[model samples]
Target: MKSTPSNQPEQSVQKTFTNLINALEQNNYTNFISQGNPAFKEGLTKQIFTHVSEQLAPRLKKGYSSVFLTKLNQQGYQVYLWKLSFKDGSDDIVARLSLKDAKVAGFWLN
Candidate 1:
């Protein structure tokens, strides 16, 4: 799909998630999302909360809770970045995901 200003990021994120979920569902991998990026795509996978916590422990700011998803163009492919955070000095988690073969892959905690 051609990218648009209003919903490009959301569309890409949804597509990436759907692609991963569909592939797992078709293969009878019901616990795919819950399993957390077990299938590596582009050398990235979903990171555990523990891993995320450690990364954000030092950079967290107060009242800065928010989750975000962004679509980026890289080397001729689309990449997605997701960030989850909480308010009032809470930990923040960030992940980078990529799409490949109609599947979500390549996750990293930031």
Candidate 2:
């Protein structure tokens, strides 16, 4: 889809996505939610972050990269998609990140 100013711009958010991965690898809960929106920061507790970090740590350590796919404007957020490829040649995963007011609102992989 074409870019829109209302939704957070993709250029900056792309870099944030990389930072998210870095946070996961390092298990830095503070850094992980540092850029999150107020609601996101409140909702994503350190316990939750720790759990996710532990789960994804292996793949993260193996190294990975993402390719921007598209961005969708929905429910007052900018939903960005990417193709996440692991360096270990594991199957690729679809990564989704939602941003509100230029901050991360939600994120997941499928």
The prediction achieving the highest TM-score against the true structure is 2
Candidate 2, pairs of clashing residues: none
- Alpha-carbon RMSD of each model: 8.2, 3.6
Question: 13-109 in candidate 1: lDDT tens per residue?
Answer: 6665544433332432333343234455223333443344444444443333334467777875567766656465455666576655445556455
Clash pairs, candidate 1, are 44-106, 44-107, 45-107
The Cα error of candidate 1 at residue 30, in Å, is 6.8
Query: What lDDT would each prediction earn against the true structure?
Result: 0.49, 0.85
lDDT of 1: 0.49
lDDT (10s digit) by residue, model 2, range 1-110? 89555433356887899888889889999998998988889998999989988988798798887778888889898898888889988888898999888888998878
Model 1 Cα shift for residue 27 (angstroms): 19
TM-score of each: 0.44, 0.84
Which 10 consecutive residues of model 1 have the lowest summed lDDT?
21-30
